[model samples]
Target: MSEAPLAARPPAQQDPLPAAWPDHLRALPALIEAAGLVSFDFFDTLFIRPLADAEDAFDILGESRGIADFRARRRAAQAGAFRVMQQEKRGEIDLDGIYRCFDGLPDAAAVRDAEYALEQEITLPNPEMIAVFRAALAQGKPVVVTSDMYLRAPWFTALMRRHGLPEVPLFISADRDCTKRDFGALFDLLSAETGVPKERILHIGDNAASDIGKARERGLVAFHYREPRLPPRCKGISPAASLARALIRNHQQEVPPGSLRELGFQKGGPAALGFLDWIAGAARRDGIEHILFVSRDGHILRRMAEQVRPEALPPSSYLLGSRVAFTLAAMTPANFESHLPFLLSGADGLSPAELLARIDVPAPGASVLRDLGLGPETRFRHDQPEPMRGLLKAWRWEILKIARRNRRGLLRHLLELGLRPGQRVALVDVGWNGTTQEAFVAALRGLMPLDVTGYYFCLADSEDARRRRALMPMESLVGPDSVSPGMLAAIHANRVAAEFFFSAPHDPVIGYRDDAGGVVAVEDPGRAPTDGIQAMARELEEGMLDFARHHTGWTRRLGLRADPLGLAMPLLEEMADGSWADHSGLRLVRNFDSWASSANHTMWLTDYAARP
Candidate 1:
């Protein structure tokens, strides 16, 4: 049977028109109240291509002969042909005939691939629309999606779960052996399943003919979404939602009562902050009173909030956004809620679970991983390699992935120079002349067994009271005052041997001066100290390469590895300070950027005993 004529329903007698909507668009909140199930388009309406620039595509996979030009033309043709196909489909044309018509287009295969790639590639959804979904669930409305494209159901369902959307039902034209314009089959199936009158339902979609016009042709109120750049096919459409939001704004209404306190609805944790901008906007529009943010990393939460409100976000908006606002006391699930209140009250320290619990709104104690049905190894799939001889293998993948040829060459230089195991070395890091003893101590701790020690002289304006104050915090909490440079110098002079000397990349080269005013040799007690330093430097150079090869895989996998050789090249150049004279036993391996670059702070060497 043909679909019931939506136009047959008698129109409601008009009530005195209130202030017309700003520019006649219905508010989103008002639209939801006026209807039951709202339909939406999936692709462009809900999700968007993350790469805005056309060149971004070519940049990702590298250049190919004629690839860029081919891609541009193919996209243009596919879009034009798709539009024609859409019109024909609305007139009930056969799908196979439509496909055959497009088969003759120039670069038809390329066009098809581009269209498929839109689905195959990763997509980021509009955060604002997701908030609308959550708001609908909060109102106890039944939600379903209808789509023209043959999208994988589980994938979209997982996408919904990932974005903090409640798990709900869905419908697709492909599943029903139908297409977008086949409203008769779709509406009949939905009406029978939901048992809601067709008039009570409202459809909102970006498509003009298939979605808005067809739904309007039936008895239901259909709205044209008019949102820019909506994808061709989608099911969950709600044009009324935007109008509803505006209505809520115009009425200055409180959010539907008990929305926040509703069952199975709580705060989100780490992932929640990922969508802060979306949540904050929805909360503001819905008049949400409080928002709670929970995360193991307070720093991340702070960053999220900073991004969302920047200048205006306070703690009491629709959501509570914080580091650990839930269960802070317990390590396990059994004791989680027991300690939740104390943690929220700041009486307990933050725990990891509490952090996650505060952010998640899933069924309470619901294993979010299991609820979404993701595999345990999903996160590690990209990093793990096939087993070799029954043991996990981590090949050196990181260094090889470096984009710049110069950077890779520099890394090679440093690897050739690093200190090997069982070798002694002396390392010195330069900072302010007399400011940070902490830096010296840290260097000593990190560069262990290498006889590494930082050297700095005392500040000129030293005082006893200040020196004592500095020492007091460490020993007696009331003992000495702040430390003075003179006190430090005195302590060092008495305890440290004069044979030891400080090295500085920026310092003037001082040693024994020859008759020509050129430096000859460093005079010391039997020259043993200088000889030892040189010996250590030599071993460091020889062992560098082997260590990098063995450890590259581990470092890259953990994101803790750096190409010391690569990072070192720039650093060595900086330390040279424009003096490029060849040293007998040492070569500039890498010159890492200084703190000024905010990238890495390292300068490396290839040989300590010989100059290259």
Candidate 2:
């Protein structure tokens, strides 16, 4: 049956013409009141798939389970199914039909199940269109869903009810085995079922061609609700109901929200929540009693925990520490060789005087290096270790003597900062090989004989990690080598981005000294960070804290737990792929020196692309 030839009623006299694009959705309620019947497109109208595209669900289903190039394969399967359906004169292909045409049918059923789950996960209620849906019902107009979608009636109705959408008649093209392309056959069926003429019906949807043009073809007044543009890094992954959205919406309510704050709220905050949740769970599983948030990366993390510690999480302390601080304080005549690499890491192209200063070798002790046939101005690179190592070794004792004195002061500082003899502690940082943990352990050798576990954001999976794994327990929140490897690898290649995210607003802790008999941080008198970086840092900090506060309230309200990691994966994937290089806040992260390597921040995205 085809729609009867009819002329659509003009828009309501009380309501002005609907605005263009995004504003059209908001103006839809007035149009609904003008009609005897209101038709809504199922997807991207009443609800949305908060993914890059409708097909992105297939990629998520396949990639999340480590199926390589699953999206490409899934796309091929769907195209093949469509071709088969065309030959058979079939309607929109259902999920099962697409899978039946799938290559490697052995895994088809499993992947299909995953596809259903991912669809369920990514689906979101379009709040503005939902308002239109409510208005239609409120006007006593007959409301119905008309769509050319694969999802059948039962599941579609189920989804509507699940999201609090009122029960109404649905006219699905797939159910009738006729699509919108069938010249209003689907709309005629809707008119027949609802007993409302096509001319008096008002339709609202996202697609201009399928929803607007087709409804107009059916003599129904159509309103186009165009999707809004997402933020720079948020493209392809911004879920409408996510914490990132919540933060963005909240920030927009403020007088003005900067990109820096939005970055933390949308990207860093969710990532941090995911990592923190993982860390807390791991710590509890390992029976850890106390967690140490090692400086300077842990500053924001520590504050987040303080603001929102999940129920019964282990006690935490913001431990004042760094690789150079712990390594220099722990180094002795016997272990100076082992600590030498960290000392000379960024010291390659400088004179002995500059190198001595870089390595934290004190004034008088560094002067002892001149006696070993190497003047204060002698240039030696650590990479060519043969001559430089020999010269450094010739006077290692004197340099270490000064280092040993600092070690005593550090022990006192650590004690004052709350390290004890036998505490079951864990060291936390934005991770890689657990070098800080190793140095921290060595620093406490005489003072605490403590065997502390290391909890990193991502373990480097290197020789150092393997060696340290034998010495003490270790766990990583993110896996570059294992779980979520693709996303994590993108994250790894852009590790500089993570450093940029967690950059702090304070000078780094260089060393410790006695202050009125109590140990205090002996920070450098000239504490210089990249100019303008701290403004971004403070904004990121505020945004992250804001997320933590809201996250606590939301999880508590929902009762059924939301996946923090799931919220983070989308933003992180963009980061891994270098999409965040455009963020203005990240650009301020210059000369970011971490893990003893210094480089321009956010430049790694280009550098990584050039590799191989």
Candidate 3:
């Protein structure tokens, strides 16, 4: 076919080119119009396989052919063949040449046929470039294809025709025994055979060195069709990770500006928006009237919700409260004994007055401590003595008094929100055992009648959470069920980073108090320090927002809303697993919680590298 001049042949009638070209081929039309003849590089330039990489096709071949070792053998043989070809300076090797490298393999013909079948199954025409080819034909410009592949010219032409390309002159390195990579021999051969002036031919392909560089050396115009380049760290990973990286790259390419996908690139952006999206849907489904975001994790969540879907979601407010404050405010004499261990867990090495100060309760006077048979300088430990327990038991009434006073302050705060009795109000929070919600319910028991539901990103399957029928758990991509326990632990280890990212700039809630005027929330003294934590938090927030903005439109167009949970799982899993190497740079935070008294006394989260 190459013996005849492509320019001498008549152009074939074809359908008009697509009005909108794919991103990579947008420049092809102009390049084609400028040249009298155009040549396309086959393989990636005009076709792309859906597989993660080209060699993945061999794996499919091995599975289909029932030859478990075929893929490995094929790779070894190809590497050996390429070494021989490079040594010989022949520039290329055909299928037979490659097969000859595997001298010990039985039934070479069968193996070759299996590979051909696999290629047929995996090869797909790149529509964007095909449109460019068709456009060249319509514009009466002669066209041909040149490839560096080891496949024979006939097989290449046949595959092209099967994929809807019109028959045209073809030049392959294997058939010619010379490559475009060596001295531009293939281009010289094409010019000699097709009788087309090298200066008048334009070559368009993905490889800069072989196609563009070689063609340009031969005085032909070259258009580089750029493809996404994965970072060096992303390549050569496990297949699952490689595939994940490819999927991420594809998502980035398809994502529109200001969509969820774009926003998600910001740290903590996707999780925040995803949780809010789930909350909005839940509120709509359950007929919730008011949404209260529990501080301080809910602080950022509320802000994100307002920015992303203000109109679609119900009215929301940031309620100033936390687990520690609410748990203390809701304590009663009846439950005080059962909760004593938890309340005093963080009070190790503290004196009676200091211990009382920690919970923001008034410390009993020295005379009262002495009367209760306790010294002012007495220290508390994880395992309290019987005397200390008795002393705690005696102080229950005072604790209850303080709890009731704080409860009144909480009730007054809620009343100011103007929520009607029996209204369905949903409390939003970052998940765990739902202790804050439980405390809130206990505090408001007789003060007000309201149907309150707790909505969280994930609800821990703890005894406390199991009994709460009013708690609504939103399935998260990075929860226990979605990932292995080890992975879940890894995420928990990063809680400090997560919390820092999700937290607002304001101080933490201490407790509430009531005066003659009204209820007031007491906040911590100063802002959380700005350090590496803040930098990481900013990254997470920006990443999530960017991903949300970028991918939201694509998600809608692709009908991804049908299984939003499934769609979100992989991305979340990758992030949770720290699959991307860039995630290694995330600041590792060490969190020490004295409240946890399990056998594994010091819980480790984040800093997987530093884990003992």
Candidate 4:
């Protein structure tokens, strides 16, 4: 019988230090200071073991005679035993107890040799991870290690300590025989030990069900540790990133800007009513006899106006208990302003003093210098003497005040044209949906009651038509094919008896055509609606209603369905007796146009230029 000799093995190659560590990661002290507590995980997440030998290696090697050769077999045996132990874990066997049981085995050296051999083959620290923990320590971040293992506390602690992570706090489920996945156990332990708010505690681990997901579900921000050997499905799909993004989205939702309720308007019906009250109060305070509220979309406003009961009326001109005397006239701002001078002139006769007398107003204050009448051009300099200067200043102020009053009176006279309570008024808008309609309705409802006895018809686009399909089933259902801008306008004029309309301006069915004869379509996805004025006005006129008053005259509130200024300029030009200038208020409100129409012309030119 012959004995075999041992072969010499080459020295192991050492890993080189990384050229440069990430500075951001290196500056973890600030983060640690910010974070009250830090936590970690163990096992495959923090440490990974190498490949194993056959299933029965350990038992086979246990029968080997010599220690040197047995060492190699022991390594193989250790891996086999670890595999068996892991498999036993699934079958309800305690891995730690198994390891301890092996500790008490008869061939202790063989087992020890097996463990050492396995350790040499498989065990190593993850370098980047080493950097992370070390950086955290430098930043004064307290470390806590949590694991869902069936290992003894002493053994786990000893294992981590051996792996350069001893300073970190260790919270092992098996240590207390309480798993981290058990929410009550983890919550109780975290609350009792850390005394930190549950929200402040961040649990980082690999398992979604047991670690990050459960922790996050309990209002804690969970940080899932990504490991390299993870399957592609698991990569970057941790609940941590999802939770963070969801939190941001939720925050954004909670603080959405420009909502009517957020703007101090009451929610629902009360908001509509309150808006009317606000508008009335503002009109009264401003002494504005004629208040024109032009909307590109006027559905809700028109509804409210039509629905006003007599009891909702404010009594005195601009003052009664619940009623206000201010007349509500809605047209495109351009049209309104064009006729503004005449309207103001008409309102010149509306005496603020008369209105004040109707309501109970306190007496005016007495003048200190009563009889000094000065000319309009009388001047006073800053360098004038005190007493005489004061008198001259007073006289000068009186003259200036009178001039200003007269100027305002002229403006009022011009603006007061056809301005009277109980006068025929209309609110024009661009679209049927959104806040503008809501706001206009509230304002109008405050003024006059509506007539619901009239017939109802809706001139809508494909989108709106689709939404209203259930209501208009038997009617000629026009899809994209039959619907056009002129067709929709005609529909509003002929079918709805709509006094006011609201619709999208860029909607091809209602949008304005420019000078070179091009319809304004939103071809550029990059562009946003600058303003909805003309569009709103056009929608109000075209999409909303066709009104036939007792006078046998048809009035349409046409929204320019363009930008406010864009819509305004064209209406102004049209008012000057040009080709588009046709202001017969009895038939149509105004033509809404756009400054941005040129962009459409440019696109047309570019198209022609690019032709083959």
Candidate 5:
């Protein structure tokens, strides 16, 4: 049965044409108006192979034949065949002639069949060029297709027909044993066969030598169809996608909505993947066997790490502890005196109940409150330190009791995770002052002898963080050298948003307590407020994963890997500067006192304002 006509098939998706055409193609209308006929060059002009590189089709063909080194062998054979053709000044070689270069190959016929099948799978008509063909035909202009490929004329006609193009007169190099590259020979043959005037015959194609240079030399009006160049250092899937992007942009058209989303994800996802890879590599290098991702902020990072490099990374777990939880749990009589500064710094005008809530502890019993000469109505003000000091002295004993219990519970939880003495462990968090690490180490001292290190995304240049880094080895993926001042401010101002994005679907870790089973983290029954923020976070998270998957595949194909720091720094900067996406109206209502106490107060209030 005959195939359906091009007009009878379903209309393909239409992409907007570019506003301007190349200088060569710009003369097409006048040439068509004056000419008796117009001819098109196949391959890159009329049809684009779905593969990134045409040679990749051979790789697929080899794989189908179960040849382990098919790609290398195919490359060598093609090179040899082309060299012979070049030496003899011949047009082209058929599949049989090319395969002759591989003398040791078994069942050459099977390989030929595989090549045909792969071609059929990867070949796709260029929709924009096809539209041009349709328009020319509508204008009563006769058109034909001429190609320098090894495929037979009948095969080329059939392929075009299958892709919903008119079955125009077809010419192939192998069929006539002469190519357009051989100067005037092919054009002379075409003109004699079609009875068209040489000057009036306009030919459009992608190759500069065989299509434009040679066609013009033979007196045919030639238009050069330039293919978009792939980005530098791009390989595998990236090259193909990047080329497509160029084509879309050159057309002065927007990409499809789905493609836009995919590209956005690609920008961010690779960074996350790169960072995870870096962390895994660092852990291995340092002989760190356990990775403890701190609660809330570490939640999404841990998930990304598991997805990207599950087997390559060391064992990981989410340790449910926050700055508030750890700091409060680490407090005691000896340290309470020192921590009084931090605790009371932002305590001005706070009621006794409110102050206790900030400390992650329940209000003391009525009898304890009475003994401290304080009631629920009493406010802790920084201006009057005497009464607050008296109350702290009275509450010191009870506070110590609570801290000791929590510290023991924390130790038990560590033991449950199989944390052993002298083992190296790394604590991961979105860093500020490294308070969580210090609090954790202080709680663990004399309780366990494990050596601990801290890995942060970025560390604030603060005295406390510096002191902690001096005593305990610490590293940051994003630091002063990597982030700009504005970007750092945006990041600092959006801590709540970051926490919401990274946190698990659970409540904050209030404290830890021993149970019949063992040490268990105590959590609030209510879930974090995530109605609006959840959707945004999920969109970003999904985009990151998708990009990572594509980037990782490309890296693997090219036998090279991307640097995590290089990938992560730019992404973080974009996100921080609000240049990534419009985050208007997204408010982080919760106030973080970390900003007030730290030296990094350059954060802009506009960053916190609702987007218009």
Candidate 6:
């Protein structure tokens, strides 16, 4: 294949040209002028890893090949190989020699070959450093590349050529049988062979001890390359997470303004990826039989899961679910008080009729309120539990009839949907209080003996969720002690964004319907998405899935098993109420009546929105 010119390539993929010397290298030009020979460290300085660690190569190999603990095994093999080579007084340890120590291994050659392929695939050329290298050559100074890696000299040469590195001398440890660390070993050979005095040679690399300290001791001037990395955008982020943000920044260069794909790729993708991986691992660990991603948030989640979920993890199915469907279906006249907290979520300090209307009450509604001795506009506050309980009592029969009908249909829906009695299942959702999970529990009570667990993206009011811990096995990505209070706050503050991004482009489910062939989710047409929100949602979901697939591809190719949640925080934080991001399309998203209860009023996520 022919190479695309950097100028014509997407900004994200284009490397910096020779004119790209920045502040860090302001001193380099003078150093290059003074030196007769410029020696660059090959791995960190020239070839770079998108992954966080070198051992990750072994981990990826193990996962792909189905080998157990290959990282540890590979490390042990290298150590053993080095020790044996030292005892034998052979030259420096090399790749072939290391594999020889991997005893009793079938397809050792394949493993070795796979590792080599991974090493090459994972490493990319450092654009800025490549520019510095070209500048050194342009100045007519002799140059060479040095590396202490165990790969073959020819392989290294080919890698250099492919990356457009000048075909200069190589002082590789495996090839030269001496390393830069071996007290004056490779340096002595380099100085003598190149006929450049040690005082006039300049060495540059990332390792402070080896590249700077050791080289200066050998009478060569050294520059600690200090290879650049994106800083942690949020607290407790990993290097891999930081790199994820860097990847997004690179991606945004070409992305259009208000691109839903960028938003999903930046925030939603990582969130789903992390949450899905966490739940998949948890399901596998807990021996879960199947996972039901509760709708409509699960609409996007179910699609993203296939990209990152472990094969050993149980299969997943999407449950046509909603707060209204689950909560209302599971309600009873006697337990109306039990479900009052959820039903009255949008009714704090509001009219009693407001709650009834949200739950869809019919005949005698206005007149029934009068007969019950409570007017239509009667005030009800969250603090007035007594009044609320009294109101629920007056309308118990009317509500119970609807609840029972909803319950019957919802139960039939589940049974027809392939979930039966006695199955170990997990309920996955973009969570707050594990409400749907609990509702599923209540709806299935007496009908089925299924074991159900709940996995949420986050938990709100952790203390409240903890209070119900005795009732169900529930887990969250950002909840309780798992994350700092600050992170939890950020997550809570951005609930609207979370809901908007993950929500399916459909109406909210009020209950299930028994159609001729199967049970279909009955949606509240009143709560249906507007054409604008629906269109944006479709694009958002498309972008989110796009990100999932691209992320899977990039991470797998680089042998990085990324922390999806930690990596997601940077973009999520930027999208928060007050951050650097413009939040153009996001600002147009309407705030929801929590759980689709109460009045379905729409409020734009603009100045009226809450802030952290």
lDDT scores of the candidates, listed in order: 0.33, 0.65, 0.64, 0.34, 0.64, 0.70
Give lDDT tens digits, candidate 6, residues 233-301. 343344346445545432433344367767776667777777777887788788898888887888887
Clashes of each: 70, 1, 40, 69, 3, 0
RMSD, every candidate, angstroms: 29.7, 9.0, 12.6, 28.4, 9.8, 8.4
Model 3, poorest ten-residue lDDT window? 591-600
Q: Deviation in angstroms for 501 in model 1?
A: 54
TM-score of 4: 0.26
- lDDT per residue for candidate 5 within 157-258, as digits (tens), equals 668768766666766788777789866578877787778878878888878898889889989998777654322222443322332222222222222223
Show the colliding residue pairs in model 2.
490-576
Model 3: residues with Cα > 4 Å off, grouped in runs: 1-267, 346-354, 362-380, 385-402, 462-464, 467-501, 514-519, 524-539, 553-612
Runs of candidate 2 exceeding 4 Å displacement: 1-204, 208-210, 219-224, 229-258, 310-312, 350-406, 484-491, 522-529, 561-568, 582-584, 594-612
Using lDDT as the yardstick, the better of models 2 and 5 is 2
Indicate the residue-level lDDT of 379 in model 6.
68
Clashes of 4: 69
lDDT of 2 by residue, 1-612 (tens): 233222233322332322441443566656766788888887866777534356645544554567767777878888988998899987677778888988775667877876665666556666656655665555556677788877677767667668765667777876787777557677767777667778877877777787878778988788887655333333343222243444443234331344677677767887777777777878878888888888778888888887787463687888776776787788887777886666566554455544555444543345556555566555666657555566557658767765776687777765766667787888888877777888888788776776599888776645777788788788776664445656655666667667666656765665666678676654431212345656767888787777767765645533324454565564566566787776655655653453332221222223332111
| Predicted candidate 1 versus true structure: per-residue lDDT over 1-612, tens digit per residue | 112222222222322123343332357667766677665566545544433332233322212223435444444544554576577664223223333455345554454445334334435454444445445545555656665654445656766666555445565664554555756466656666777777877665667877766666666566666533222321221111111111111111222212211100111111122123233444455443333221111222334355433543434211111112111101123333343332233212222222222222111232533444332222211222121101111111211121122122222322234433333221111212222233222222322222212111112233543463254211110111323444334323321110111111111111221235421322112101122333332233222222222222222322231222222222222222322223222233222111111111223332111121
Per-model TM values vs. the true structure = 0.28, 0.63, 0.53, 0.26, 0.57, 0.62
Which candidate wins on TM-score? 2
For model 2, the run of ten residues with the poorest summed lDDT: 596-605
| Candidate 3 whole-model C-alpha lDDT, 0 to 1 | 0.64
Ranking of all predicted structures according to lDDT, beginning with the best and ending with the worst:
6, 2, 3, 5, 4, 1
